[model samples]
Target: MFKSLLSDRPGTEPLAAAFRACRTHFVWAAVFSALVNLLYLAPTLYMLQVYDRVVPTGGLTTLGLITAVAVFALACLAILDWLRGRLLLRAGLRLDRMLSSRILARVVDIQARSVGQAPGSQALREFDNVRTAVSGPGALALFDAPWTPLYLGCCFLLHPAIGLLTLVGGLILFTLAWRNERDSRPRLAKAIQSNAAAYAAQESVAGQAEVVRALGMRGSSIARQIDQRRGAVAQQADAQLTGGKYSGAIKFVRLVLQSAALGLAAYLVVKGEMSAGSIIAASVLLSRAVAPVELLVGAWPGLVQARSSWNTLVELFAKTAAQDRSRTALPPPAGRLRLEGVTVRLPDTETAQLRHAVLGLEPGQTLGVIGASGSGKTTLARVIAGALVPTAGDVRLDGAEYGARDGDELARFIGYMPQSPSLFAGSIKDNISRFSSATGLEAAEVDRTAVAAAIAAGAHEMILRLPHGYDTALGPYGAGVSAGQAQRIALARALYGDPCLLVLDEPNSNLDQEGETALMAAILGAATRGAAVVVVAHRAGVLARVDRLLVMRDGAVQLEGPREEVLARLREAPPAMVAAGRA
Candidate 1:
């Protein structure tokens, strides 16, 4: 833990900027706390001095005055302490807000493919770590720095010998705590990764509950996930326990040091080497000195955790958009998409998903891509839509290449819908509009378009049967909606954006006969409206209506021609069913 804190970049400028922004109020609050502590310290000194001097001299008047002043000081100290607490609380809240905003912006600015390509749970866990760092470590740092120095200075002024002793003890404790933190950090990071894997296991089982039950592996699957999670938690708990024991030992050292100082002071008073008043003042100061040490020891672990989280956030935000960094000075898209010898290989897969596969489409021309499972149809769509850059070759959108343009700049003209579509939690209208701020589209206008798109996708009748029409709430990832309905909602969203080119990857994969027919009509409708459309078709019903088709196999185009000729060829050569279901 000590190593983690010591190794971290001291005082990040972003955090410093946040501190400076709120420094005025925080400084005043620190001053108030210091004054309160001083006042609280004064009373012990006054009582001892008066007893040592005035009682022996029989001066009751001086005693009474000192007593009154002491009481007043105590009251003032209480009020100041209360005010300081309020100020610190507000300061913490503001720091949390600042960090939260910055982290959220960083997460959004990260490239979509970088996040999406990660194992789903790992990305989510990384975000959780970022949030914890912001709220947990960010707030603690604000309250700690001022208090440590304040009390340390007070101790020195009271008695330098005892002050040095206390400071040495604090240093020892801090070193021990730091070591513990450093040792625990790697374990904590490992636990976090393992827990993410366990979560993934649980989600996988839940998603395939029917299959698991059919195979009689429901109990085994759940048990395996739970056991894995338990093991991870146990490792984390062991690290925590070891760290706690070391922390406790540090606290014990503090107690012994404090006791020895008090004992020595009493012995000196008895031997007439030190005055009773001096003993009293030193004891008060000693207590103040220990306060910061105790607080620091307690806060060190949180600091390390936050640093670990900060590293994760940095890694997440460092991804360049569309996985390319060479492109500069982007040009406008001209609605034409050309895949010039494009190829992609899955990062962790041994086999290439695509290999130097070339294809192209002119402006306002629809091109349907057909392939067997693992034939790289969706990979081609991703490359064309500028979501994934090709491992080899380049995609040109009109005269300008995709690699030369920014992801957002290219995305404005090219829209894409994946085989498995995910939706946010909101009303149907909100999901359909994607919270876009385009000037002409309002909530009502989006609702109207959503309904039209749903009807075109053969989802309107099902949506109307729900509790509300377009106003209905779709739970997270459209949980309450059917698979087909979720697909329609995604299609609606993509259609509502009305991009120059639409790349739909197996859009009819989850649809029924009726739904497939409606979707095919919608594709034709989009083409009628001059929006170029490219679809990956498996069913014969949707394939028969397309203008042209390109057949893909083993990561390259096996055939390409007019739709009628391609269909005739496909009819003559039927692919195996098990080999054709990519999902």
Candidate 2:
């Protein structure tokens, strides 16, 4: 029955899997926590013994023995508490070891599928909240809460009236905590949303700082960010105020209950119905019984936040897990690229980005795609390189569907350069090698590949002229390099490892005439080496050597065939029409 219950809980399977991997530590920590709670009764028992047995009978030996036992119990309690903390720390570390990599990979996958629309950093932050909550004092308080009844039972043994009063106090505090959660949850959620909006605003401004400054839009942007931040702060303040009210009520009620229990016990003593020892013990036990409830009230906000974070992470994991289950491994591609009726539909519009784009290229074939701006050339390039999946139809390599292969593995054999080239904070060699150490490649092999790719891209001479040659480090986005230099180095990276498929988008956008010649040569060289090369460009000069041509307009192919035939057809068309097609 317990197994069935566990299986029925959402998110529990993954959580339990992690716990099982470190079950020994968890079990020991739990045992120690239980022992520590049990030892908590020692103080109350010692007070009862001293007041009733030692003081009444003047028994010094009895007092000495009781004191020694009380001290020993406390010492044991300290040791158990330390051990429990250590065990929990180890469990947290083990959980991180088991899940962090999987979570990070899933985040990357989510980002790719969403085309960077999703807030991946927020998702990662949520996961971190879950981990911290699991190892935090709030979790320990929750574990100890169940033992509240035991302490109350001990109070009942002292006197029924005291126990009943303590129970009522606990119920009141619990009610307050429930009210706090119910009232503040919506407010907290709104605050979180506002915070995210504020962060997004800041990120947008930061990314376009140069534009903001150039257009004198800094003031307006700052105002917008401030508005978002103000909303977030206001919502947070409201939530805290609501929670504080309930927290204050709980604390007041707890104090009253403790004093009332003591007063009632004293009244009973005066009436010869109870002893003084009973009063002291009853008060102590009542305090212990209600401590967990007090702790819960105080930590209630953080607990709620953690619960929300956990749910978000579970949803993300579930989505990623489904994707993983449907994916399969396939043999490496052999440069035979085919697109059968491929279509790409934008999420926010009715028009398709690419419509029934059917094309094929065998080994050693070079295809040049030319289109006007916003004619879907970049989209086609992305789809061909597997950066964006087609909305309809199939992308195949060697007669096998590209979707069948893992995305990362497929990416390894395909070289892609986007319109705006980007580089990480690494040396030129590392960028060209794609940071191959991450793939466990040896240093010598990485160096060989980097040097070869640089030469193939005609970047070797330029790179060598730099202060440190290939060892020179570049800042984010290839800082310290000219636009032409960055483009060539990016080309080098795309050509690395002699990938079977090459997709270059606007490869000459920032290149000089010399660099353009080098790029054209590189494309021809790739085709000669039995690679299937696809270049998307607006320049006719870049497409002069292509064996085939595809001219796209309005997301559909308007002209396609052998280069000579396409060029001949274009020549016969009106000059105005040809210019419009280019536009």
Candidate 3:
């Protein structure tokens, strides 16, 4: 069963290549282990020989000589074992880092659909499990596997029958353990999934701390949910324990097989087919086999987990990223975007969110996209920004086919701010620069210009009072900043790139009137600088500032013209008309 669990799809070329990079250390380690084993074997054989000689001749000097030789051999074995173990450990650690780096790179390259579909915990856990597998049990398994057979072969040469018997016994034990491992694979996979779900549920409760506290149902409402998840985790732990027991049972069965082999060897010696010296030597070899067998048994769980992790990692490595060809060089946008029969569809969902939507925006134009929540406004913006592919349509930037260009280059031409912006754990300067090394602006440049711009955008004078000013440390996940401050930081990051067009999803959110005024001024500034802007706004004051309004109702343009014209039309009809049109 244990053997079966380890029969994963062979590792890929990259993993093999990673292993090869540490070949020198592995070679030296193996050489040292072989020398130690040989020294260990010599002392055992000499002791057996001395015993037979002493029983017949009663030689004292010969016995003393044997004792000294044994002591020397043991000393040599100890030194070699220490050296080999250290070499192997160093090599294993190096390989672990190499493989981890490659895996993370692949993870970063993964497509949106695959990345989104994969649970975050699963992706992260796989790397850790595989690293332990490769660096710990994996290294030991590799060395012991070949070394066991070599040591056993020496015994076989001295007594062919004994060597053959031990071989057969070991094989049976391995087979039993492999089978147990195989049967546990699916159970382990399911257990991992269950654990992930439980963790996600726990995170949900923890993340919404304010809501749970404000509702004052913490002791009564969430307690039941928390208890349910805890029970599920306990059940998963029980399942893993059951699998562990199966492995233990296999080890016990192997021990019985080894005992049987030893008994048969004794029978051969008694029958006179084997010499007493050979019997003694065989016994020494058999005792040595115990270490190898136990090593394999102990490594079984790590190998099995590693196998599962490798399977997932291989899939990740083999993935072909979706083609994103929006990077071709194009003339800077003259503030014009044309969409022909644009449609937006989700990869994992059945329904198309936006159907055959048509729209156009000329240079210096400000389009306002307004609709009830979940009306596909955000999806449409994503398509226009080239972050997402339209099911059927072409988005032309300044009359150039958008898809023909490079996606990365297109990103450089447009400033896209999603509903929520992510900030790394760093100083204010790092948040604004986002570590972009795009030729003209470096981190220091962003520190001077971008930091002030972001503060100006959000009317954030309070930021100046921070202990380190722009260099103040932000906690991981931007915990040090407020929602409004983070948003402005995102705005600063967007502006740092000096994009030709701006797309803001909810720029007016979490801002006071003064902050809103700064945001409007920033948007107008971009337009005056020859860049067009498209905004998704709900605030009346915010909507009134835009040059034009493209109200999206049911994923289609409802009323698009000058801002005053659309606002007048909206006023003539009841507010419910906008909701009904969107529905």
Candidate 4:
């Protein structure tokens, strides 16, 4: 675990490798820290010489020379501090350059895999925390912390009494830091969890705002969010209050000890045991001795947070690195999809999600899948769309097994329209031109293809009626358009490239009667263009125009035949059986 914190570069081990690559910077920063701490002695030494030599002998020339030397030492100290800061800043930038993009890709991949079940955005925030804390006060404190003993040794050389007091003060500050960690850790952890849950809830509501507002539940939704986060807010407040108290106590200790060193020196001077300059000299050294400890104590929270973020990132990267990175790209598929004994199982259970399911589609074939909820229709659709890989079977396109890199190339040939309109923030033209090339083509060629796709989906007139037509801007998840409108736009996207494999999961769920007619026409039109299409719907009415029908139950296909044969069997079945299967 600790080894990861010491490595360099961002290649496979992004965090560790980056740190290792910046090792030179860390070494120079440490060297500068040492020089700065040593130069700090100049102030104490100058005070000792001035009061003992200049005041007692009244030597103006000697005082001037020593003062100049002290000023030079101070100047060098300031320069070293600045150089150290620059080193750390550069290291931070280097770390970011190596890790940020990798972290972002991992975040997106995690979200895509979980289908938004996991709040992966939190990982990006964690990356920010790590970067900030690494180059912020906590890291500086780390470099300075090891010099505390050297500072204390100097204090002892001045006077053992002064050293003892500084040591006691440092111990007190360290104790308070420990107490702060103990006091804040639980509440802060709870607060973090609550905050994540609240954010996930908000994303959920925002994604379904159309449904929530249409049902007049907007007020209740806000109330629900507030209630969910009340505990988290309370926990965060309590943690901050406790941390503030400890920090205040640490400052109080450092201040009191510095003054105490001065008083002790004054008493010794009064007894003729030391000269008057000893007072200031002892005080300065004592202050320097405990300052590093005070910094470490003050930066305790940031140190802990950075450590946590590092560990989290390490684990995430470790998992990702274990997977094969090399992927082979295959040729574009010819619309022949064959699934043989495909199986998908729950991660923690023996129960299968898709059990030994076999299906096939030739070019121009239209298959409608019908099943009740939990009957694996969505899972099958996801597998066919290459969104999810099968656990124990082969999913082949044109006799080629899908490789990791092949997915990207295959994407150009597979058009998947999920039940929820999967749209991004962009112009309608950009969204419809999913596979359109931006360069090396006539501007008219790209626009013409986008418009052609929209026209084929029966959305051309609707788009033209809008203020910007194909150039209209949209928000997340096809926002800036109504549900039916978004659905039509999505269909256009799926039909954009005239992809050989088209998979739509409940594509007509949000459509009106006229919209439904257009959708049916689009499906038939795609098949006429030699694209193999699979449509999943719970109701048979929407699938009336399909060439074949497949009914699923408990993750297995229960019935499959030509469309007419399947419908006739469903009609002749007993009413109870028909309702049970929802066929």
- Ranking of candidates on lDDT, top first: 2, 4, 3, 1
- Tell me, by TM-score, which candidate is best: 2
- Candidate 2 matches the true fold with a TM-score of 0.93
Candidate 3: residue 116 Cα off by (Å): 4.4
**Clashes within 3 Å, all models in order:** 3, 0, 22, 7
Overall local distance difference test of candidate 1? 0.67
Q: Return the lDDT, model 3, position 319.
A: 56
Which lDDT tens digits does candidate 1 get at residues 1-583?
Answer: 1122222233234445555666765677758856765686676678576758886898988888888888888889888877776675666567566656554534443433433454222444454443344334333344444565556676566556666876787678768767777777787677666766787778878876778999999789878987998988887787678778777887788778778777767776787766777666666666665665566556655555556655554454344323334566655454676777777766667787778887767666677887777788888877776766666787777768765665555666776788787777887767776755344557667667677667655667767777887778987667778888888878877776567788888888788877777788778877776777888877756766678788878778777777767667766664652244212
Q: Give the clashing pairs for model 4.
A: 7-20, 8-17, 8-18, 8-20, 8-21, 9-17, 9-18
Choose 1 or 3, whichever is better by lDDT: 3
* Deviation (Å) of 470 in candidate 2: 1.9
Candidate 1 accuracy as TM-score: 0.80
Ten contiguous residues minimizing lDDT sum, candidate 3: 1-10
The Cα local distance difference test for each model comes to 0.67, 0.84, 0.68, 0.81
The C-alpha stretches of model 1 lying farther than 4 A from their native spots are 1-40, 43-111, 115-161, 199-216, 320-334, 386-393, 400-412, 435-441, 455-458, 564-583
Candidate 2 accuracy as lDDT: 0.84
lDDT of 2 by residue, 384-456 (tens): 9888877798999888887677777777889999898888789999999989878799999999999999999
